[model samples]
Target chain A: MTITDELLRNNEQYAAQFSGPLPLPPSRHLAVLACMDARIDVYRALGLNEGESHVIRNAGGVVTEDGIRSLAISQRLLGTEEIILIHHTDCGMLTFTDDGFKQSIQDEVGIRPPWAAESFPDPFDDVTQSINRIMASPFIPQKGSVRGFVFDVATGKLIEVTV
Target chain B: MTITDELLRNNEQYAAQFSGPLPLPPSRHLAVLACMDARIDVYRALGLNEGESHVIRNAGGVVTEDGIRSLAISQRLLGTEEIILIHHTDCGMLTFTDDGFKQSIQDEVGIRPPWAAESFPDPFDDVTQSINRIMASPFIPQKGSVRGFVFDVATGKLIEVTV
Candidate 1:
């Protein structure tokens, strides 16, 4: 059986004890932008229960245009106020460069990607970068408390980055 | 105290019980693209542990160009072979059209957004659209097991979209 089938079975188990239909808006009035790293589970790391916060994630958690789009919707439509940015130590984004990644894809596919891969050199700097993007965006309101942190995968501690 | 402080306390607790750093690549070789809805915890819903799969999320779970970028990275560098796309019922994406959302924002901010809101009328059709986007992208090499599902908000169950 495929791993997808295995996860489907797991979903059946999840649904068996699941109690939901929570309100559409996040109850905590918070939103988090985190990396799509397999090692960091956003909810458990933040002690979040279901429906507590809106969680947006991508490859580097770099707050790309799409991240702004998600955050804008979270604050404008949903009732999220505070924003959290989580990048992690030992992130894959740190291992590569944007130009090299795009070029590799272009060499293989014969057409260069129109977008940057958003590779970053450091998680701490990228967290600050993400916060700055949110602060600079006219689309995202309620930026009074946007904080950024680097999650240490080994210790599972969140070290805030003061920019 | 700010909710960020509250969550920082929670992170301390998580760290107290934390385990060591896992491998960078996903153990299951899987990737999940999901909505940034508060109620749907992708790891819990799929019964995935840390380091098992990459979870990429955004506002509508729509496969935008960024999603393609992430999936390409996941497959090319990270070795993820399976992909799962998740959209949910009662999603905010269903509440408005792209033009209306951008127009409202433009009316308030005096500059229209260059990106579409990616609002959709139905979760099922959007799941198909997401699947189609993945299938059509050449950057993402693995198309054999790209499955899409509509997460039922009330039921907390994943319903596969047969597209």
Candidate 2:
């Protein structure tokens, strides 16, 4: 069966497994900021179960305005004290040229490039750069600790990039 | 060079190319709620650029309490009105048994399993179910739309699932 079909079936099973709120374990409440690359399975990589940590993902794993905003809120309201930024290998963000990506989007959907004035950033090489970018940002909570890592999609191994 | 190296290098180039605030595109302020599986590249998969969308990720792409809380803020404060949920294949959430995962954590880290009360809910079959759950949720903006999809990690193709 397709992944979608499989997931739908499982959800039904899960809904039935618990009649009320599935009792969640008390979460240590760590927050992770990582890339949205499909290869990095946060739960498995961190060996976490439900209600353990809050994970936020985006392209390049860079801390954008919204990312920072969310992180701020997570720290202020969600009880997340630690942050982990996980970037991965062979990210398509590195493969596509900015002009090419814009052109492809324009051609596919018949919509003009939204941010034609802005160029796309390439995020390949020294994962620490992205980590540093996030750490350097003023939006992240100054008091909270931030960690960075490179997750190898092929091997499922996580290598620490920065502390 | 390895994909990780390439991504870091590419990010530098990307940063150099777009040095200022990106002009927001019309209808570009969207929020994507997707899975944390490593195989999916949100930027390439959905043709998104740096300032286009806010991506919130978790296991099974499920909209947990934190996700809903973020969605409220993203919609109310961050100009995000749309939501997309993407789940993918060969998910570790499907293969690793909850007991195995918990036991491995105990063995490796010397910490007790946090969610000792419940088993890890298989997420492969839970994505669509999660989608439905999100749609039915009262916290999501009533006027906003939620889209669901299952991405084939092996092929890098996206198939739309029901909303």
User: Across residues B10-111, which tens digit of lDDT does each residue of candidate 2 receive?
Assistant: 344443433333332213557778764433445445545454566667544655544554454455334566666776655434544556655654565465
Q: What clash count goes with each model?
A: 0, 31
TM-score of 1: 0.99
In candidate 1, what are the lDDT values of residues B70-130, reduced to their tens digit? 8998999999999999999989888988999899999999989999899999999999999
* Structural similarity of chain A in candidate 1, as TM-score: 0.98
Model 2 RMSD vs true structure? 14.8
Sliding window of 10 residues with minimal summed lDDT for model 1 chain B: B135-144
**Predicted complexes: DockQ each:** 0.90, 0.05
Q: Model 2's lDDT to the true fold?
A: 0.52
lDDT of 2 by residue, A54-141 (tens): 5667555655544554454455334566666777665535544547755654565565434321123433343556556656654444
Q: For candidate 2, give the DockQ.
A: 0.05
Of the true interface contacts, each candidate retains a share of 0.86, 0.05
| Cα misplacement distance, residue A66 of candidate 2 (Å) | 2.4
Clashing pairs in 1: none
Query: In model 1, what lDDT does residue B101 have?
Result: 89
